[model samples]
Target: MRYFALATDYDGTLAADGRVTKDTLTALKQLRASGRKLILVTGRELDDLLQVFEQIDLFDYVVAENGALLYCPASRQEKLLGEPAPTEFIKALRDRQVNPLSVGRVIVATWHPQETAVLETIRDLGLELQVIFNKGAVMVLPSGINKAAGLAAALDEMKLSPHNVVGVGDAENDHAFLSVCECSVAVANALPMLKERVDFVTDSSRGDGVIELIDKLIASDLSELDEQLQRHNILLGTKKDNSEVNIQPSGSSILLAGTSGGGKSTLATAVLERIAEQKYQFCIIDPEGDYENFEGAVVLGDAERSPRLTEVLDLLEKPYENVVVNLLGIAVEDRPAFFAELLPALLELRSRTGRPHWIVVDEAHHLMPASWNPASLTLPQQLEGMMLITVHPDRVAAAGLSLINTIVTVGNSPQENIKAFCEALGDCPPQIAPQTLETGEALAWFRGKQTEPFCFRIAPGHRERRRHARKYAEGELGEDKSFYFQGSQGKLNLRAQNLILFIQIAEGVDDETWLYHLQRGDYSRWFRQAIKDESLAEEAEEIEQNNRTSAHESRDAIKGAIAQHYTLPA
Candidate 1:
């Protein structure tokens, strides 16, 4: 997990003699610059601490009076965590010749021997307050008020979890906050007791020590790793990192089971899109000619010409998307033979490219027969990511169905198919029948016994392609025939141009930089630049808009044009 916040004791830890050194101050400022939350846990009174650390606003928040009071450095506001000392108790301490000093909120300190009367009076009042010894100072506050408690209170106000924090300290009072953090660090000059109990002991002392810790953290690559893990949570893994997704080891393929018109293709597209986002190449068997429009994808077969297996394999070797093997017009008997030849080449390509993120076969029953042995098509385990989309999951090979790492069922009648899938795999969780899976809803079956299947909506951002599928089917856009010609006359040429520009922006080229090439009439270079662009943001937005507008216009025009030209013998 990313360390979102840092909790450090002020006196003796971050600052010696209540004054932070210039180096320590700079290090803290650097941590702030890096977007880390800085919290100071201290035993000093709020105002006194502020006096010592005059640039108080450097800290995001502060825990003062050990753990009894909290303060916001930016607002200069203080919050007392406990009630003030009773007037009677104060009077009693004074009567006993004890010199009671008001420190910070709810905290009163006094010397030990003369403070006996105050202690007795506090106990007599049946209060939970207690006096804690820090060096020579006897500090009194509500019982359980300590540096750790103070830090916890401050953290609550900030909505930060201890698990996302790393505490650094050198003193006894800092122990509470240190022990609770995910990573506890101590400086070299720190007390041996504190250092021994902490998770990491830095070689440097004081300010240099904290900087050393930050340097180590940034070098560990925790930030990037956390980002990927978060995606895993939303996709294949559990919602929280600690909760792992149980992928059934035996499942060789995940069957996207659903009825026709139930967003099966869209859901399948989402899976492949995610795989592609991870830079995994994919080959989608698009029998219905769907998936060809996906960006970065290659269409293998069309009414014009079907690419040879060698051609498809070559394309697969170079990371491309929507690598479609259109088998729609092929005779039914010929599909198996074609797939038989195609599968081995795909398996070889998987071996060559170290496996694309996924191998997606849509209209599975039509292409990959249940009787066909998956073993024959199996790539080495190192390069295997398989996905099958079918209306009838039962019709797909039971053996093939057993290999699913994740099963996304879209329609209502999938209980039986899921049940059969479980039976084939042995001890599969009982299928939870979706009451109503409207368009983007799906039940994702995770791979472990302890985990439960989740019914989640594919986030709207991830569902654009799926929405387009509905538009494609509805004739809201032109019919499928129109898509072929929409780009034919180059009316969609701007889209191609914009798409190339979008890619250039993604590839770290600024608009001004790419515009230079476009102004120079470098069309070929422009497209090349766009194809290798790595920015997902600009590409997705442009592609989304491009498809919506051009695809819509092209669909309408192509349908009208076809009708106008092809009138029959009346």
Candidate 2:
């Protein structure tokens, strides 16, 4: 389901004359029966609200006193979310003759024309408090406490994300929580400013408007909201012209394409970091173990073992937990079959609960090869919250490519990569000027938006990128391809087979042997040809060419480079 909860206001939204109609109550029950949660956010005190309405139990949770308290109707448990109203502040208000004053667990409220006195009292008392106005009423709360904070606490207890909630209100104070919701709604009778700031306005007023929204939610799960998601779109980055680049989180697919050694993984890391920071659950399909270092995501499996599908699914069921499924132990050829089985389960889970909001497939070409058939795997008609990363987009299965609505290309030849992806889809590539992107930059093309491709500097990732070490440290190498060390006395004819052995030999050998290799450019040559890493080789070359360095210093520098690039096996 797209929306899992409906958070509505009480006074001017669901209640008229301080009472809920039988028809509105019936609608609320029907909404709960549809497996959706109900949250009542109101500025009224719990005692006052209970006295006015007898059907308060219809709501699972109530945030009262304008975010000062959280109440669970079933358990009849009330928790104060903020500090109590200060005695001095309350006394000062009374001294100022603030008539008809009311006090709750953490809120002090009164009608309009008294806000000036309330502000003066708060200032005189030097209290960290804020005043909120709702129509003719004025409420004072702790500085950081508001309807949004209260709703957050309620949702946290319910294990739900604001991204899965739709909030409705009809007044000024309601803006705080409504703005935080995935979809903001307002009743037709709401204030002009309130209605203008929301995504949708109901055709009816008060309880009838709420009933109208509930009916629509139960019928379609708010599927019509897909078009209005632009208001909730996330900023990817800024373009060259300083325009903001954005993407909708629902019913969209993004493909990151580039050659090896480019910033493809870096760009993916930035995007994932934002997704994680936003509290959206994501599952990363890591083919080369690239994303295990990401913060807040649990890494499953390793080089020695394959991840169990059951464990992955279990972890993702929790709304806040994320998982990285490492495919190191699984055979490369069998990845598609494994993913074929996993996709159906994931889709089923998403259908039942809008969880595991995103699925990022790194090295996507391996799992969805060009020869693979679309019908071979279970895929939703609309691919929402899916991201595919690949070095070669043309190598991915046609079915997978067909679902992609956005393309982000990195590297020196971004235009060529974009062209290749377009050709793979059998569509003419749009004309884009060739531009050189820096280390953390890319060209973004939103096919669905049909806008011209623009350049955007990708944001840096939160977690430090994990560099692969096993490939250089323990990988087997042929004798002829190994690094040979010659001593001063004679040619030892000794070969270091791997990075670990090379480091050991370099450390033990005499200064002459090290200098000989350095002067001959042998270290740089070996790094380039054997490891196929130009950047590492360049650093080694820089150390060799430094005339100010001694033979021992050079050897130490070379060893440091090897150790930094490769991890020693335990």
Candidate 3:
């Protein structure tokens, strides 16, 4: 978390004799420019407060009268947080011939020889207040109320927590605020009690101390952030040939090819369960809709009806513990084009917000066939944590395998898939078959140049994990017919995995020509049945119209047109 607010005491903490130094004001201005909220929590009354710092809008908010009042400098608005002091409390002190100075929400006086009698009078009033001594000044405030409460209320308005707040003070009254902030700094000239409770004690007193703290904070934040990297198992290092190569956990993608009841889905579910335990967000493209019930999952598309693209996009934008996109019920012919439109938007979002720890695309061949153009779409340079599961490894595009960091094989009779893998992986040797694999057992290859694959059996999911299981359903037609249509669509869209099945199928068989047609938005021949609802169909038609018009318009003009489309009335 980053610091977003600073609450400092005004008198002894930031200035001397209620006078702010020129350097202190300059430092405060710099922090304000960076968008940090500055709050002054003090016991001074409104009039005396403005008199001390007459410059308007110098602070974002002020906590006047200790914790009893809140003031917004920008709007010049004042709100009282608690009840006023009892008239009897002040009148009794005066009855004893002891003059009490009423300052804002606080009352102060000198430590007199008859202090015990004065203390008894205060007790009799039945008011909750504390006496804070700072040199010769004795301050009294409401019970359970102090500078800390003032700062807390200010921070709450800005949606900032104590973990992201910093406070600086030098007197005993300021102790409450200092203890709650993430970082509290005490000036050299501060009281001994305040110094002992803070994190860092600044060497410079007054305004100079304020400048030193900000400089250190900015320096530490930038450096510390760079050291935290996204966690992934795939390793990348130099090969024996002194060439730079990747050692993926398995390979670019893992195709779980096997007959029905072969435990492929079970094995994949186990891996997903383990990854979720690590707390990394992952999205499972469940064609069968079996993984929706898992914890932290954001299910999309289903056995009941496939989800619209826009709905999935909305869920993706919100932070999720785990996201499972179930595309199981969509027609087989639509999966490729569905992915085509969906992948690009996902990639664009990933570029903006850093990629998910893993993008588990189940039934890979349905969305990405063997001849699809991988170059046209932006690929995550570091594909250390991507999992693609499929029963038809031969149907998955070979070009997509080049970026695989790992390959996990979960069933038997993988001779054809192995041949396809060797051919797609560039220079790779064939491997002897593994005789047998249990329900969760798999042959894991972690890198491109490795000689042997690691074999391990995955664990089972807990009973609690059943709620988030994926929604599974068969496609429009059989697998073979759908694969042919997807392969013939020129080049499938690799940008959006969800919209690949909806892309306009372009004519021509050549890979280059197919890729060109797909990129050019030649979607006249394709339509997705999954988005047949009235509102969704209209939106889809609008998108097609926009894509068609984009071909003849200038880029800037197109942007202006889009802006016009989304513009709202004043």
**lDDT of each prediction vs. the true structure?**
0.62, 0.86, 0.59
Q: Which RMSD values do the candidates have, in order? A: 23.1, 10.5, 23.4
Off by over 4 Å in 3: 103-118, 218-570
TM-score of 2: 0.70
Q: The CA-based lDDT of model 3 is what?
A: 0.59
What ranking of all candidate models by TM-score puts the best one first? 2, 3, 1
lDDT of 3 by residue, 151-234 (tens): 777765544545456788788777888877656778888988878777778888866777777665555632232222122232
Better of 1 and 2 by lDDT: 2
Q: What local lDDT does model 1 show for residue 237? A: 30
Give me the displacement of residue 266 in model 2, in angstroms.
Answer: 2.9
Off by over 4 Å in 1: 111-118, 221-570
Models 1 onward score TM values of 0.41, 0.70, 0.45
Measure candidate 2: CA RMSD.
10.5
* Winner by lDDT: 2
The candidate 3 region of ten consecutive residues with least summed lDDT is 466-475
